[model samples]
Target chain A: MRLIADLFLVVGAAFTLFGAIGLIRMPDVYNRIQAGTKAVTLGSLCLLIGIALLYPAWWSKLLVIGVLILITNPLGSSTIARALLKAGVKPWSKASVSQPGEADR
Target chain B: MTLTLLEIVALGLLGAAVLLSLLRLILGPTAPDRVVAADTLAVITTSGLVIIAALLGSPLYLDVALIYGTLAFVGVVAIARTIEGNG
Candidate 1:
């Protein structure tokens, strides 16, 4: 049981690390939001579950946190994306990168 | 009070994750980019808080994690709405 819990924790941490890397490496805010939200949400859930396994008595609190993340993470990311669009932020595209002069128009 | 090897590795990975996210938060080119980084940082922090609770062998920290997660979500939504400029 302890071994399984450790595996979950390690895997969750690794996923979170990937999400952060994506946030840094992605070319635009949209990509960064997608990477950060999806990966980190899953990572967090895994971490919570692992913690619950390690301490079974804490399952109720862990479940609450997990559910909160599941709902809010995606909702928050979408809200940010919508806000960015409303604020006139353009999404990055291959065409924009390939034809830099065209992007200005 | 000693951590097992796996716990240490998990902690290291989470620490690296936090550093990377912080780098994005600092270097992000625009407001929305920074906001996204902040949101990601909040989620990571929530998980990290839970891990800390486990490490400390206390249930009290779980309440902290819960409250932190709730407040972070509310804060993010408010920031996003302000950025949207509907008002």
Candidate 2:
């Protein structure tokens, strides 16, 4: 049980770290948000599960926390993305970047 | 008391991740970028709280984590709305 919990913690942290890296590396706001949402949600879930396994008595609370996270993470990310789009933020246009003359500049 | 190997490693990794997100929040180009970074920071903080709870063997911290999660979501939505310029 201890070993399993430790494994989950390590994996969750690694996922979270990668997610942060994606945030820094992504070209635009939308891509960064997408990276943040996907990684953080799953990372939190794993951490919660690890905690639940480590302390059996905390299963009920952990379950509720996990469910709340499962619901809210996506809602917030999507809402921000929608608001960005509505506010005139455009996704990166690869075509413009792909033009050799534009790239030269 | 000395920290366990697992605790040190976990805390180090989580801390690094949180710092990276904070860097984004600081240097992010646009308002939406900062919003995304802040949202991500809220989440990482929640999980980091849980990790602390586990390390200390305190269930009360779990409640705090729960409340923080709820607030973080609300804050994110509110920021998004504000960015949209809607009351």
Candidate 3:
């Protein structure tokens, strides 16, 4: 049982690491936001769940945390995206992808 | 033991999903893409919070997660409206 719990922890850590990587590796602001939000959300969830699983007695609380993550992740991303759009940020075009959009535009 | 394996797999899958979403973020051409990315991130965060709460044996964390989720959602809506209104 303890071994199993450890596995969850490892898995959670992997998720979080990837998420952080995605945040940096992805291209523009929009993409970055996507990477950051999705990766971090999942990563955090895994970490939390692993902790819960390791301590099965706290199943109820863990359940609550899971629900919260499911709800909030997308909401934050949308807010950020909307703010960017309002500021007049444009989307990537085929041409823009090959070369950074700002230079081409 | 089996349950542990399943949880690991779930985490892996969720991680992959986050990556897929990241692709959208990278390729997304507009501000909305990024906004969408952020939104997606918020969802993932909420999920993670619940998972940890269960693992750690604590219910108190749930309330904080719930509040955060609600606030984040409201924030997204507000940002969306602000963008549309300006446009």
Candidate 4:
């Protein structure tokens, strides 16, 4: 039990770290949202599972938090993307580089 | 409260994750970029709270994590709506 719990915690933390790295490295807001939402959602779920395993009695509350994250993370990302679109933010594209004015908007 | 080597490693990784997200929050070029970083930071924080709960062998912190996650989601939505400027 200890071994499995530890493994889950470590793997989850690693995934989270990668997500943050992606947030920093991605070129645009949309890409950053994608990376941050997907990776961190999964990482958080794993962390919750690990904690549940470590303390079996805490499973119910952990499950609540996990489900909350599972639902909200993607919803929040999509919401932000929609807002960005409505606010006139454009998605990044390689072709935009050739057209400097296009890149600005 | 002694931590196992694996737990220590996990905590360190989480710390590094938080720092990276904070850097993005600081350096993000646009408003949406910063919002995304903030949202990611909230999720990481929720998980970090759970890990801390495990470390301290206290179930109480899980409630804090739960509430924090819900509020963070609501806050993100509100910010998004503000950014949209239509509602």
Taking chain B only, the TM-score of every model is 0.94, 0.86, 0.81, 0.92
Give the alpha carbon lDDT tens digit for every residue of A1-105 in model 2: 877887787778878888899899999998999899999889888888878878889999889988988899999999999888777777776554554422312
Top of the candidates by DockQ: 4
Estimated TM-score for each candidate: 0.93, 0.90, 0.57, 0.92
Q: Against the true structure, whose TM-score is highest?
A: 1
**Tens-digit lDDT track of model 4 for B1-87:** 676899789889999999999999998777778899999999999998888888888988989998999999999999999999952
How should the candidates be ordered by DockQ, best one leading?
A: 4, 1, 2, 3
Give residue B32's error in model 1 in angstroms. 0.9
On the 0 to 100 scale, the lDDT of residue A1 in model 4 is 93
Supply the DockQ value of model 2: 0.66
Pairs clashing in candidate 4?
A: none
lDDT of 3 by residue, A7-77 (tens): 66666656665665665566666666666666666666666666665666666766665666656566656
Task: Provide fnat values for all models in the order shown.
Answer: 0.90, 0.71, 0.33, 0.92
| Model 1 DockQ, alpha carbons vs. true complex | 0.77
What tens-digit string does per-residue lDDT give for candidate 4 at A65-99? 89989999999999999999888888888654675
Off by over 4 Å in 3: A93-104, B1-58, B83-87
Model 1: per-residue Cα lDDT over A1-105, one tens digit each: 988988999999999999999999999999999999999999998888888888999898899889999999999999999888787777878654554433423
Categorize the docking of model 2: medium
Prediction 4 TM-score vs. true: 0.92
Error of 1 at B77 (Å): 0.7
Question: By the lDDT metric, which is better: model 1 or model 4?
Answer: 1
| C-alpha lDDT of all candidate models, in order | 0.90, 0.85, 0.63, 0.89
> What TM-score does candidate 2 reach?
0.90
